[model samples]
Target chain A: MRRITILGLTVLVTAAVLVAAPLLGLETIDPRQVAGGAGAGPEARIFWSLRVPRVMLGFLAGAALSVGGLTFQALFRNALATPYTLGVSSGAALGATLAIRLGAAFSLLGIPAVSLAAFAGALLAVALVYGLARARQGCSANIMLLAGVAVNFSFASLILLVHYTSDAAASFNILRWLMGRLDTVGPDEALRLLPLVAVGGFVALALHRELNLMSVDEELAVSRGVDVDRYRVILFVTTSVMVGGVVAACGPIGFVGMMVPHVCRLLIGPDHRWLGPMSLLAGGAFLVACDVLARLLAAPAELPVGVLTSLLGGPFFLWLLVGRRGAACSA
Target chain B: MDANRTLTPVLDLRHLRLELDGRSILDDVSLAVREGEHLAIVGPNGAGKTCLLKCVNRILRGWRGMISVNGVSIAAFSQRELGRLVAYVPQVGGRLTPFTARETVLMARYPHLTPFAAPGLRDQRYAEDALALTGIGALADRSLDTLSGGERQKVYLAAALAQDARLLLLDEPATFLDPRHRDDFRRVLRTVNRRKGVTVVEVTHDLNCAVLDADRIFALKDGRAAFCGPPEQFMVREVMHRVFDRAFLTVNHPTTGQPVILPEVGGP
Candidate 1:
């Protein structure tokens, strides 16, 4: 009953935020206007085409990254593990940099060329990490972690090379893209990320018990009937795919993947059954809140929501950890 | 468990060999354990005692040989099937997850459950009963990380007991337990073996434990089966010396008349 109440409250807050966020941007949009079907004006287009999609993109990206982070953390049994631990973000950044440098102007299958390249790069990084870290037994956590770090370094170097050789305009574009944005061209980007989040989130939540068992001990999990090797690969692939889509849509928005799950874990306790759903909902709402602040903090101008997430998340997470000493987090 | 089933071994290993990094851990080791029998695997350090249990539990794969449980080849069984047949407790407790004690014990019901389903009333009852049997009921709500080493180990034992498998493979399970808990554990093992008709295979360095608790003693030396016989035959000095590379001073227990093997110290 208590768990349900907690989740119910989260759902309420997330719905409220979802309803209210799209209307509170630089442009004023009435609640009834948002509720009623598309009207004919600049306001209707701004509300329907711009604000709503941007907020949806923020929510999708945040939910995907946070779930990815928690899944990785549970898989590796390390609290510090994040979505980009295996170089997915760095790989996406490199690909996006290349796309910007080459001035790729084509879209395929209703998705932009840059997003496709980003997804491809993210998959490549995961493949490389898996191949390098895999042993006869499987991918051991320590080896995989080290492999991820190495891959990150390599991708970052490549991204630096792309950034350095580009002309001034392209360099600035790369710099701004690196900061991350939730400015959607339409509902398309949000729609693109939706299925990835749904599949990844559903799989992770459905396998919550296995995640618990695996988090405790790989050997124990196997002895208790979990196919550790097979599930390990499944988990990695799912997280990578969701993270790839998110990174493709909005560049690599940092901190949501790293911080949101920790906060959710501390709030809901580490039972992934509850933690999984809570992380997804809270991640979406928290990003919406941050994006709202991003629009409001600098009136008439806006900072990238990514910058605010990383900046706000560091101090907030530090403050959370500072006094409590992870009393709630450790559970 | 039946009279006729006793004629065939419940657990059998043939030509079981394991190699790690080009060096053999277990070389052509073979043994059979009867149903409802308590078999103690006794050996010195690096004698592959733990490795043998792991092989039986199918935790350490890539071994070259046949392992059959209940007359069926282990290879034919899925991991879940194997889990329902055999339970394992490591030399020490596995890593501590964020679950409380009761939650940890409930996880042992995994093999019997479908994916995505929560543990039902029977599973919860078994978990509670296991915790009570292990004398850690008061700690049921405590997170595993907060428990002491001995307490944590008891939680793991409770988990294995709750697993309700036919065979139990324990690797020095009492290494972290207090003497009182050890006595309680021994009694629990006796009841589980005699009353429940469950097979037990324990790896222990303590020879006294073997003679006292086990129906048979299987001694290993350099990963080879040095001795496999009844406890009475295994109590002989020649068998002990061959497996352990040492001299033993054997004395009969004053109360039970069972021979106890102790190390012979020259200076003393």
Candidate 2:
């Protein structure tokens, strides 16, 4: 009954946010205008072309990141894990920064060259981290974590150097992209990330039992017949690609990856069976709600959704930790 | 005994050797257990008793040897395939994972069910049978965190049983249990061994329970196979002393009329 209630609440929140968030903005659109065909008026154009696409993109980014985050936490058996735990975000940031610094202008498949470059950077970081961890036989989750730290710091340094030498305007642009926003994202960006989220969500759902066993212990997982190493690699590579796509599309929208799964675990519990879908739904709704707040709180001058996420993530976790309502550990 | 000798061993290890960091963990160990046999492995700490079990289950690799379950090499089967043949219950010191006793047990049926497919009637029946066999059916819905150590160990046992494997490997399964729960656990294991016709191999610290329960005992000392035979041979003072490097006293239990081995408590 409790599981059903929590899952129902998640579905409700997702529905409410999907329906309500797009209708709200700097200029409110009539629901009937949106219900009318495209280009019925200016409101229709804004609704069809801008608000809906942005909310969809936000949903894609949140769902992908949260599922990825849940997978990493289970793989590493660490509650602090997030989609960015493996250096993908830093790599994407570096790629975008370098592109902005160099003024790369070759777009392919209708994708901005910057997005392509960010994706390339993300893959490079994952490859490097995976290679370093595989330097020895039987790569453990701890080894991969250390490898991620090494690559993340190195990529971060490179990004700093890129930012430090760039012109003022380009540096500001890079900084803004890093802070992440959904304001200008449209149908094209949403379409690009859809495959990634689909693939990531599929892998996570398929390995739900493995996720549950592994979170208990590696030995436990092995004894239960999980192809521990192979599955770990599969999960790692898939989530990296999905997260890379998300960061490329949304500029590493922060907190949804870390915070959503944590909060869902609190409301529901650690059974990955429910946790996987619930995390995806709650994550999407949470980010959209925050995106709405980002627009509304400052009206006419929008706060980047990334700024609000990080600003809120730390304090909310603190509250979850210190409040007497009591938070349970993943174990 | 002649008919048993003709049957293929349910578990067989041929000259297994494992070395880590320039030290031998298991040295040239070889043993075989027939189907339905209950074998106990006993040794002091670091004797590689648990390590031997780890090698069988593939949790610890880098060992040079051949291991076979039910006449097939361990290499021949995928991990999932092998899990259908051998279930391992590791020592009960694992993190209290937030699964209910039932969910944790049902995970044993994982290797059997297709991914994304709900448990069929047979799968549910197997889980229920395991729960009933281990007498944990009442605790099936209880979260692992809410379970006591003895209760949790029973949950692990139930999980292994639910795998419906032909053989079960346990590592110090009752270390956390008190005397009463330990007896209950032993009783459940005996039922699984005798009634279900499943082979059981376990590493144990309780010599008395081992002698009372196991059909045979395999003792390891300093990474070497020290002894293998019927418990009647193991209950002798000199054999026990040779393996443990300490003296022992043997006495017949007044109630059970069985030989019990006790360590020589007084100095030399």
Candidate 3:
């Protein structure tokens, strides 16, 4: 009951923050003034075109990645598992890099070329992992993780090769994107990606019970009338869309997917019905708060939100590992 | 007793063959378990006992031949349908998270639940009743991770009971428990079979325990049924020697009049 209450309060707090962010008198210029045709001032354009979209994108990306992380972790039944652990992010990065190298225009369909490439790359990576793992009888969690690591390493090398060959300007842009900055996102881009994220998130939510059973024991899950292979395919594909979509919009934001779910699991019990959705909401709030801190701490020039999340998540993860080990050792 | 009245078999396996890695594991194994009957499968290690159990639950899908439950081919049934009919409990071990005992049992109802729908009050009531029946209602709120080996085994049994399956397949349910707990586990199984009429097929290495409760005993040798009959048949020295490949002295229990086999000194 306490945990439920905490989750409820957290949801309310996050909703309030998301709603009141724009309305707060943080800056002198009123967004209403700029909208009322008051000379089309720079501040109003920045508010509408820049900060609002960036905030929205941060929330969307954070929620998507975190939920993807929860799904992957449960599906694999590995504590160290994440969506990118399978090389999806690296694959997406490589695809985006190749697209940029081919001179594809970002404004072609109101969707960035890089994001499109990333999505395609992520799907391909998932296919590759599934294909390799399925070849040996059935796709067990251990085999999938091993396959993912192999694919990730291979793709990382390709990404590095691309990075070396690219020109200075392209390299700089790629480097910044890889660090995961939400500064360049516009409101239109967030609107474009929201539907895909929401749909994928909902599909994931629906499979929570099956995923929980899968986490316990795959063979047991099969006996329980769950089509284990089919559910695995659905879960992997859905996570691909969520993670691939986010990686495309913003470069691989490390640890959001990894840390958020683990933290949520510790706070709430291992019930996926609550764990999966709460991870998304908490992850979104966490990123927004981190983004706000990144902006305020380095006003005029912002720190990459990914950097802050990693800085926070890395230490917390190590602490959890030590604590878990201590508990196991003592027990 | 009406000896002419044939009891309907709840589980039947005919001409069953299992091949793994180009090696035959189970070959032409045939068995029939009557409704509400308690059957025990005994075999030496690596005798394909586990493989046979897996085949019954469709965990090993590549097996050949006929396996039917309630007169329907198991292959024709969907996974959900199979789950509703059969509940499988495997040997328990490995990393387990801390789920409350009630929550753990509630997972058994997953097959009955639709995607995105929560369990109704009826489901909860059933779960509660199952917990009470298993005699673990007091431990319902405790974390599974904190339970002792014996307690954990009971919890799993409760979960299987909550599934409300017609046939229960257990692989070595008594392997990790002490003698007392093992007896308790068998008592629960006997009660469930008697009251709920749930057919039980369990794989066990304990020959003594198998004799104590099994209505029918099937002794497997190299993946084939070497002996299938009453416990008294297993005590015959010649039968034991042929299947177990050892010399044994058969003696009658002074009080119970049951044949008991004791390993004889000197030769096979």
Q: Is candidate 1 or candidate 2 better by DockQ?
A: 2
Q: Which ten residues in a row have the lowest lDDT in candidate 2 chain A?
A: A322-331
The interface RMSD for candidate 3 is 2.9
- Model 1 chain A worst lDDT window (10 residues): A322-331
TM-score of each: 0.96, 0.95, 0.93
Greater-TM-score candidate between 2 and 3: 2
The lDDT values for all models are 0.86, 0.87, 0.81
- Clash pairs, candidate 3, are none
> Which runs in model 2 stand beyond 4 Å of their true positions?
A324-328, B1-6, B254-257, B266-268
What RMSD does model 3 have? 2.9
Tens-digit lDDT track for model 3 on A18-128?
765543323545656667442477776666677677779888888988888888887887877888998778878888877766667755577777778877898788789
Pick the DockQ winner: 2
lDDT of 2 by residue, B1-268 (tens): 4695438999999999999767999998999999989999998899999889999988888899899987888989888888888899989777877788999998888789886775688988999999998888999998888899999999999999999898999999998799999999999999989988889999998989998899999999998899999998898888888777788898888998878888788833
Candidate 1's displacement at residue A110, Å, is 2.6
Tell me the interface RMSD of model 1, in angstroms: 1.7
**Interface DockQ of candidate 2:** 0.72
Candidate 2's docking class is medium
DockQ for each model: 0.64, 0.72, 0.58
